[model samples]
Target: MKKKKEPLKYHIFQNITFLLKCIRREHPLLLIFIIMQVILSVISPVFGIYIPKITLDLVMGSADTAQIFLVLGGFGIVMVLSMALSGMANEGKYIMYNDMRRYYQMELFLQSLSCDYKNVESEEGQTKYQRAMSTLRNGDWSGTSIMIVSSIDIVVSLLCFFIYSGIMSSLSPYMVLLLIVLSLISLFGTRQAQSYEYKQNDLTAAYEKKLSYVIRTGSNAAFGKDMRLYHAGGWFQELRSSLIEESAKLAGKIQDRYFASGVVNAFVLFLRDGIAYSYLIYAVSAGQITIPEFTLYFGAVTAFSGFVNGIVNNLNELNGANLQMNSMRAFLDNTNDPEPETPLALSDLKEYSIEFCDVCFSYGTDTGFVLDHFNLKINAGEKIALVGVNGAGKTTVVKLLCGFYKPDSGIILIGGQDINNFRKKDLLKLYAAVFQDIYIPPFTAAENVSMQELKTTDRNRVEECLVKTGLWEQFCGQPTGIDTPMTKEITGGIVLSGGQQQKLLMARALYKDAPILILDEPTAALDPIAESRTYEQFHEIASDKTAVYISHRLASTRFCDKIAFLSNGKITEEGTHDELMQKGGAYSQMFALQSQYYQNKEVAAAYAEA
Candidate 1:
């Protein structure tokens, strides 16, 4: 069977559409502000160009002094008004940029969370995800500003250029052709440079991914100590330098291209101005133009060049912004997952029976089945233990029961209803889980134990769960009590030991009071006494609920009412502890070996005492 490819690459125009949708939908205020800035941009440059021409007429005294003063005054008034309007427009732009940044930051955070667990493991998807994240943080508003301003500049510049072109055309039709050729050449050359930048980005993608990983591993607090203790800082530094060199090589390729093209562009600009100058000289010498007209013509030419240059620069920036906008839009476009739309909201979760019939699952198309032809029927209130060696598919069974992954072929029923028919939210509410790996939340010890939002936390319930988990006296009642944060970053807060952290995770699960409880190696790191205490507490509070215990420890299997022994992808043994021992199968062999090792230890201690 072939695996389906992920829709990861977003089309360029599709990205633009995404940006527009985001601004229109999520940031309505900012979108309005952007529109205002665009209007000001269109008005401001034209005002500046025309005002200067009017001022020149006044300075040359070619018209009535009173009329000239009035015209000059009008130009001054418009200039002042334009400056004030632009200042207000710029303020709006700042607000709009900041708002857009905040909005996208939130969107990116939500998007990261919504991604499927397997997506994070995909090298390509993860790379793209991280780039999207980085750009979201550093380039959100900066990119938006570039896009909006560049778009506005392009529109304004073209309008100003046409205004000058109209006047120049009246004087000489050839001058309009000269202006069009120069404008096209300059704009086309810059667009080529922008396109090169996009290609350079693609070429250095692998190098940048390596650099990001090296930097993150070196600097993250979780890995920092390990990196320093292992003396890996120098190694990471070398890796980063290599990535930098690779990036530089790619950049150099693009820079060489740009420089070659820029020289030709510079020559084009010079030739265009030279021709315009020749026309001016001919007009003045033939008495077709006055001193004032010559001055006006020179001013118009300079203004036209400035306007066209502005448009070229802005258009180049617009191209780059389009690329970034495209990726962001693609991510946002699929915010809704392909999962069932009418998610079942769980109610009546007090029932505690579970069943799996002909259950089959595989990690992906390339992977073999983790569980095949699996059948299990667990009665209400039964405490079952799953015992397995490494790669025995015990954990996969738990994940399947929890609805994290759907089976490729099979039916799982809860209270005689197919599990798939249950809404995801409802399914989650049915069970409380403590996995093999612990999660230490960045919160107060109370909130960590309760696993509830701080604003509405039940403090007493947190205290009770901590005590029941056997960690309250040793951890929660420290200098700051339960109010103390769990992180080791600050003083007056105690950090839990590995066993204590495990106990805290158990406490969090206990607080949920779900109908079903799952504990997967929850006491692996605990001492014998702590392990016994946890199991006893687990039996007390979770007695009426269906409990699933997954562990490698054979001794713990004895506590459950029934044990399912898994070997490879199948359950090979199912019985009570005594039954499994009497059968002398895989579970019996492991149990005997473990019992003999401890008995031998006792005998060795006795011999030492003698």
Candidate 2:
């Protein structure tokens, strides 16, 4: 579908304002960068028309060698200035580009971090981010970070166009008019071609993703065993080859579009220059202009044609980039209010228990419910375990509580007030959650656990939690102790085992010690012994704090004050583990199934005693 277009003038103004902010931050580098650009833009036309005109006239007028040499010396000086400015302009572009890009990247990242929680997770929100990233990753002034440079180019191009138009006017006004009309035709054709190129980006992105999947799977040491054992190397090769062939075919189609557009532009420029040069030659032959004048007019005609074409081309590029810049703007301006501005802060959070009352939710339309009228209540400081088979909405409840997604209907309350009434960030302050997905950043262990940069740290507390979680021994072995980076993706970093990472995450949660603590399969990577030790300690550690944990191992739910079995979008069973086992319902059946191995162990031990 054709996207609705916004005005180029509006984007230009936006670009200016964007750059102005950047300039304010790093004015010295960017100011020099822009000034060098303007100087280069102006000098190109001056060299093409003015200096050449002067040299030709001087040489042709029977001027002395000494006099001509003076003019030639001036030519050398101009050349030197242009060369130096050109070098600085090119070099400064990349340098300033890196700085501006780093700045913009941080700003955009912070924007995403501060965005509405729902906006960061929804399909629509993810698409906006991908689009914004695509704009930023391009290595040119057209990229989101350097759009100010492109904006400046437009202004400089316009200024140069006018300056040259006046210089060319001595030849003929009609010539300038003719050039603009033809150049505009080329501009329109090229814009359509470029639009076609961008339309193919979705296909290109898909192809790149496929290639990335193959490369990642092939290159990763973790996947190496699977690839070798399964004999999947040939399969990967075939998949990669097919994708490359498909990309080549798509590239051909894209190139064909550009070639077709090129034909139209080539024809227009050919006709324009042919008519122009023919007119100039005729005027000179008829004695209407002298040899020197003919030389000057001929130069002007060519330069003016190029000047008109360049202006139109930049205008079209700006128009195209305007659409791309929309993605950046959309993400930055994603301020559609979902929560209250002046929300009540629950500074004292120990008094509240999270409740989901008559809650209904689905990931999207036409999908079956993940949760439906899922009513549950817990008293403050109660430790509850939500246990279920996969796809039973155990994780869904956690997400809703964390405000990652909103329920389609009904309300989630904390301390009798709707959670929606509180600021999203402030509401999140009540919980310290360790989710199933493990993401370890390449930062010091202390920073990773604290989720903050170092200024001051409670070393004793950090070590105590690490020791309690079975990670302190490994921490002490490291040269920097807890200050060691957790990823070998950086220098002198240490890679942790999966179980150790889980322990680190647990230590992180313990360090936060928020009023509400949620752990989703926190000990999945640990052995039975380690898991038992952590669960036993959790009771003491989470005392006076509301705690919820999700685990498939129903045996571990024995540690909770209450065990809730979630099934078919509702809590099918809720009670103490012994009470549920006595009731002999779904929870009992699931627990028996999950604990059958342990049951065998107990039976074997009893028989041995006999």
Candidate 3:
């Protein structure tokens, strides 16, 4: 279904209201400071226009020296007060603007974290996320920051326009009307230029996204080996240069439009000032107005031009900001699937029996189904081995069981209830899954294992898990023991070897101690002997829980209560290891092939020894 496009005014009002509400909730005093700043900014110009006229009129009339000094003193005092108050207001707004920037940045971060996992994995969702981040990271030019200033400027400029128009009307209403008409013409040209610039925003965002990717990939330490060996630095540099050139070209085009608008504005200003000067001079020569009135009216006319220009420029800025705000709002509003109104509590069940009944799913509409009519069941507390060749949708089954995704058709049940009946977060509590991609943050070993803050974590529990994974003695040698940072990114941190890192993840899963434990090729980094030992140890540790293990090595499946061989998104074979081997099916053939390879190496080693 296509979303309806909202009107410009609707976005303008909605975004402004939204920001104002945020300010009110977070920092209400900023509203007062903004109002103060606007009033002082507008009134300062009023003094510039009127004070000169008053001084000149007093001098021309030969007024008393004391009276003139008093008028000058009053002007000086007002100017000083305005400057001081304006300075304070500027400082307050600056501080609050930075605060709000950080506030909104975190809001964007949280939105990304809490949004649906599917959205995080999709290209369209990633693009929206990047756009939102880019819009907010623009500092003063960001939608949130500039909207406040632009809103205030709009109010200030409109107020000045009205006040200056009234002053100009005292001389002649026709002059005021002529200036407005010329200003409107200039405004029309400026709006067109702004529209053209806005049209290029998508191209600009794409270039920025590509440039950021290139920079990040080129600078990553993990890619250093490949880059140096393959001589790929030049390739990255060339890509970066190409993106920079494209971005520069886009910026140049936008500037060209603004340049054309400026030229048109200059011409209009020339006509506007020329006509006003000619009329004012005629009035002065005919003695229709005094010199003091001439000075006041001329100042009013010039100031009015500025007022009109301020209104036009700020309006354009506000409109541009509105577009960026729309992007930010869209990203923040990308929510997860709705939870059931009265969600079933997964914790209420003492045991969980997982089932995938006629489930069909694919990552995207264009892709073929990774799991088509897949059906499987694991009784409570049973240890199952899910083994399959690469791309056989083994991982997809685990992901579906864990509620990371919903099937396109059919249902998944846990504890004999539909999994969708439970809230997503509640469902997640049932599983402790260690996936293929390993990530241990640059935090203390204990913090990494516990997945909690160092201060709040149970050190004893972390120690126990580390001992169970056989990493306690290794970590105890470090300067901070288990409190040692996990990655070298931190000061005085120690980097873990591949096998040790795999052990650390196993320790983390053990620490979670959920009812359902999943190990997906968890021993891939270890030697064959060590892998076998670790699997046996983990099997003992997980004896009380329902566990699912995935490994390509059929040797690891001997201890599992049941072995399910997945092929073409279905279980092609299932039974105990002995039963499957006796059947001499695909599982048996694959196991024999692996066994023969190891046997060949052993025989070759023996002959070499003789």
User: Best by TM-score, which number?
Assistant: 3
Candidates 1 and 3, the one with greater lDDT: 3
Whose TM-score is higher: candidate 1's or candidate 2's?
2
Clashes of each: 2, 0, 0
Model 2's TM-score against the true structure:
0.87
Error of 1 at 199 (Å): 4.8
* Candidate 1 per-residue lDDT over residues 1-610, each given as its tens digit: 9454333365434555656777788667766766666666666656655666666666665687788878878867877786787788777766666677788868877876776544554565566665565565654345555666676677777877788787777778888788767877977887787677765554566677888788987888768888889998899889899889989988898887788778878988898888888889899999998766776677777777777777776777777777666555555544332556654445644466899898999888898998988888788899999988888788889888977777899998887777777766677788998998776876888788767677788888888888888888875447778888878777776677889999888888888988899999988999979988988988997789898998877777677899999876778899998898899899989876766665577763432221
Against the reference, the lDDT scores of all candidates come to 0.76, 0.80, 0.87
Candidate 1: which pairs clash? 344-423, 346-426
- Cα miss at 193, model 1 (Å)? 4.7
Give the per-residue Cα lDDT of candidate 3 at 438.
81
Model 2 C-alpha lDDT per residue in residues 402-509, reported as the tens digit of each score: 887789999999877788888878888888888898989889999988888777777778888898888899889888999998778777789988788888999999
Off-target runs (Cα >4 Å) in candidate 1 are: 1-36, 51-62, 114-125, 139-141, 171-178, 181-216, 219-233, 247-268, 271-297, 334-336, 339-345, 348-350, 581-584, 589-610
In model 2, which runs have C-alpha deviations exceeding 4 angstroms? Answer: 1-13, 32-36, 43-93, 116-131, 141-153, 164-171, 334-339, 348-350, 477-480, 488-494, 597-610
- How far does residue 336 in candidate 1 sit from its true spot (Å)? 4.7
Give RMSD to native, each candidate. 4.5, 4.0, 3.5
The candidate maximizing lDDT is: 3
TM-scores of all models?
A: 0.85, 0.87, 0.92
